[model samples]
Target: MKQSQPRYIMVGGFLGAGKTTAILKLAEHLKRQGRAVGLITNDQGTGLVDTAMARASDFPVEEISGGCFCCRFNSLVDATRKLTATTRPDVLIAEPVGSCTDLMATVTLPMKQLYGENYRIAPLSVLVDPIRAMRVLGLGGGRQFAPKVTYIYRKQLEEANLLVVNKCELLDATQTAKLVAALKQNFPKADVFAVSARTGDGLAAWFDRILTGELSATDIMDVDYITYGVGEAMLGWLNATARLSGSPVDGNELLLRIGCALRDRLAKADAEIAHLKMTLTATGDGLDIAVANLVRTDAVPELSFRLAEPFTEGELTVNLRAQAEPALLERIVREVAGECGAALGSLASFKPGQPNPTHRVDAGGVEHRPVLP
Candidate 1:
């Protein structure tokens, strides 16, 4: 007789999709059901917003940094094994990099084909931000992506076993219905659901499905190897940590200003902000400091920090994304911190930092060595 293994559920999405929030809600739900949960976060670089958010939950969070789970498949397995060893969780939820796709072939298919004896792969649920969906599908006028970026976005949806329309609360019923209809017509085989992680709407049904669902491998997309490779190569990732000294500024206000400032700056530079997120965890006080992500400058920010208490000192983690150069991202962080310090009537200390690039794949299907700064 063999020991029962933990169920593995992976939630994936394009840039700015609400995968992190959905995972948090799902973890909470599972915990309420008396199940211990373990979380794994993947990112293209070392400093990841998702990792910080997941860790803040105080759960057993493991991070597979510098690569998506597919490119780092062995690391994914190792992380799962470590999580299993420590927590023996009933369920394990993993969130992959936002810009990544082709999970069915690279991740799910391999997992089922190789690790079926030790774990069960839940349906691969890919989340779509309504705004991004509209932009990618040409339903609304927004920043147009280069051909390669567009290719990755579409490929992400192409491999999903479940397509979830996220941030639906921002749209009216009619608008939501229109999007859902279009998604259904386009991806007829996958089950599509509308969920607002912010409001907990339609999550219960989604949860129910996850609990009883079986993930059969789907037909993965044939990606343009070269184009796919270049698109990913052009993108640079940066995550940083900063020590702040402020006079007990309102955490929410500070986060709002910082997020808006960064969004505005990135927009002026004509750089696409795939996701710019920051999390502030205070040291002494019990209050949740602040967390905000700007998927788009024009869109409303998402908050990961809910105030349960207040604190005077803390560490702040900044996760930035842009189509600009990696150096540009570092500069942007410095400028944002200066502005935030001035607003708070004090100065915040930011140390020199570099994004540790974990994965670099080209369209030719060539893998590059990880770049560390």
Candidate 2:
């Protein structure tokens, strides 16, 4: 029998938690299972790397920018309606902004109460980078986010129905075991799973759980709006679009150079990188693209996707998130893009403002209307 409603799954986590890779993997899995999938990508600005990556895969995608899903509830609904009208996908996977939390009360709850008949809201799964999780949880030592930033990270974990530890390949048996144990102990209600989105290891079990899982009734997590707003403002966001020209240049190599340049410059400024990713697509051939990601200040950028042949010209999209000033990020990107032979076309940089959700509902089934400006 055909289902009456589509499954709506939101995969969320902190910046560089491998949400895009995991979502793509899951979409591929669903396609093989004869399910049409639609993806929704969210960001603070346009020129999003995630949006480019998703579109490259040939999936129907809708992008929601300017704010997160919670704050832009109406936009979220509009994206779904548009997708439904066009593709009518059997499953819709939405990736929320990494720094925004309080989804249980602000997003899922509202959708479940308002549009329950139109869609089946699955359990919220929040992914986490083991290295970052360890540092934040005091399990290991490394560069860490400020206290306010850590507060947002903790709140995300608190609200997740499924706590997923992605990129497990980076951890050893003992380390992975300890981290899983710690998460289970910390969030007793959430079921924990560790898998690598890059390597197909330990994914089937997780995929099965999420596909068959249902959201349960639980107390909403308490979030301090003041701290959430302050934490977001501390992380500078920059999105730039550039035209890559000059002789036939290797897109992959150019991406690495720009990523390294930004990493070095930001490190000198004492800026902790949350996530820096870029995509280079052939000027006319959208399918031919190169992508790179750098999740930490100390880590080297890795090419998640590579171009087949060198291209003389292409379109470059760069998304950078770090604990630095927006001006510094813009200057660094502008310099690096020029140095890498990419003529900067458009760029936007700013710290995200406070979040004011359009609709918020608590566990008691009461709605909290947002304060209009």
Candidate 3:
């Protein structure tokens, strides 16, 4: 990697792990250092809530939809190129698909081998939501995925060079210290950092590390693609775009109705929600957008973000990931969206489909060529 190359950093985690918010925090830090910044977002399909939310924040973002980074390696490269060519950002922050793992083998190593002349890739930083982390570590009782689905989550942490315990605001000093100790004990190779992406409590140290740290070359975690496929197939995903019209109060009410309805349905089925994210962007006001996120069944729906003021009509993007069938997920979202749309006097809809990763390259650093038949 040459000094002329721009620094590349990827922040990954399981669903609802606050990757986007952390990316925004990192981008702000880089900008303060007088470094130009660009962001890349990934998803299993188009009309992504993450992409829209990032754009709403006024960052230079390019989205790789239809698959995760591992499954869409070439598309990931293309998005990087587009950002570099247009924004010429001094630092590039990428947020991989939450459910995707094996970054050391699939993403960073390939970029270092092929594009090292133009990009200095940083260490893999995997973020974790504190509540989910506690449940996984057995410190608390909450909804969690089955063993097969959980295989992907643990592999994410296993391969991480830096395991970030995000959303520090959820726990106190003791709980935070305990979780950090557990992570270090569980994964000795990785450095653990606790930061609140919502409040910027510990972002300073985490941001400084990204700006100066070196990416480890050796790969970790032996991923089983067959099991990976099964685990991913168990998750049902839905991304929908809808036209919403109502007062600021009505808009918020409408959004709440859709969210609550889905929550009740998903919880009733005993299906743990991987993540359900929504964003409402008004025309002509990119900076003012409403965002909401729900990661678990026990959690209440709250506005992770709020606009200066809501608009009468705006574009709404809803993203859903859960342990239910695609048809059931689709039905729940559509029915709720339809009810809200009718009451609020607007159009609401979405398209849900089975997610299939188009490409799964397993070669670590040695293989320069993409795994293609």
Candidate 4:
């Protein structure tokens, strides 16, 4: 039966898990099924690459800044209402902050209990970058985050109803099987899928599961608020905007240069990159844009979207998340942007504070206020 109420689906994961790409893919799938879709993107600050990416696709999208969906519950509701009022979308897909966890307790349960009449909440789906997951699980060789940061990553998986091992193309059959087995062993309650959002491998099954699946009741994991805050503080977050003017420049090359330079600097500083992405859009033509992403320090920058024509003047937005000091990240970005012919404009850099959720549900479905920092 076609549902009357709009469905609320939230896709979450740690940084660099390809959450944005997955959400967009899911939205596209939903649209093709004759269902209207809306997207809500969350971030810690303004100038989000995710928001820009979604908007460029001409989807009715809204962004909640300055916090994750758990902390900005009211804003999440507001964005949904705004989209509902305008687009009347049948399915609303939300991508929460990548570094955030505890979505079942903080987001899904609350929405189901409080706004049950308005939206049908789907099971929480958490995506993981296979390589990162292997390293975090001590099953692969790669740079890893500190214990504190890893805490956030593990907690995300702990609360998921659907565990999606994204970027399966990056691994072989043997490696993929090993990672899937590990995830199954650790999170026995959740169903796992190995998928590649870029190549469209193993996505149809996952999409079908989410589209028809309902949120099932489960035990909520105990989260240490103080440690969660400390873990978030360990990551430096930078979001910047700039204006470009001069001869026609290759936006793709510009983004690659900036991403690679930043990656090298951070690597030399002994900092591990979570995810760094930027978008260059012609100021005169919003639709004409180039987008690039660097998920790991060792990985090369990939241009996900490219502009058809080179522009002499455009607007550039850079979003960098890494395990370094915000001040240091900001300084490096400024230097790189200047060299790349972009005049930096408004910029904000800081570490995420403690997790203070607007509404938190306990194991028994009771609501309580989380202790704030």
Give the TM-scores of the predictions, in the order they appear: 0.87, 0.97, 0.91, 0.97
Residue-pair clashes per prediction, in order, are 7, 0, 0, 0
Off by over 4 Å in 4: 368-373
Better of 2 and 3 by TM-score: 2
RMSD to truth, every model: 5.4, 1.5, 3.4, 1.4
For model 2, state the Cα shift of residue 291 in Å. 0.7
Clashing pairs in 4: none
lDDT of 4 by residue, 267-307 (tens): 88888899999998987788888998988887888899998
Candidate 1 wrong stretches, greater than 4 Å: 1-3, 285-287, 300-302, 307-311, 342-373
Model 3, range 258-335, lDDT digits (tens) per residue? 678889988888878888888776767767787878888778777877766746878777888888787887777777
lDDT per residue (tens digit) for residues 278-297 in model 1: 77777764235578888865
Candidate 3 has an lDDT of: 0.79
Weakest lDDT window of 10 consecutive positions for candidate 3: 343-352
In model 2, the worst 10-residue window by lDDT is 364-373
lDDT of each: 0.75, 0.90, 0.79, 0.89
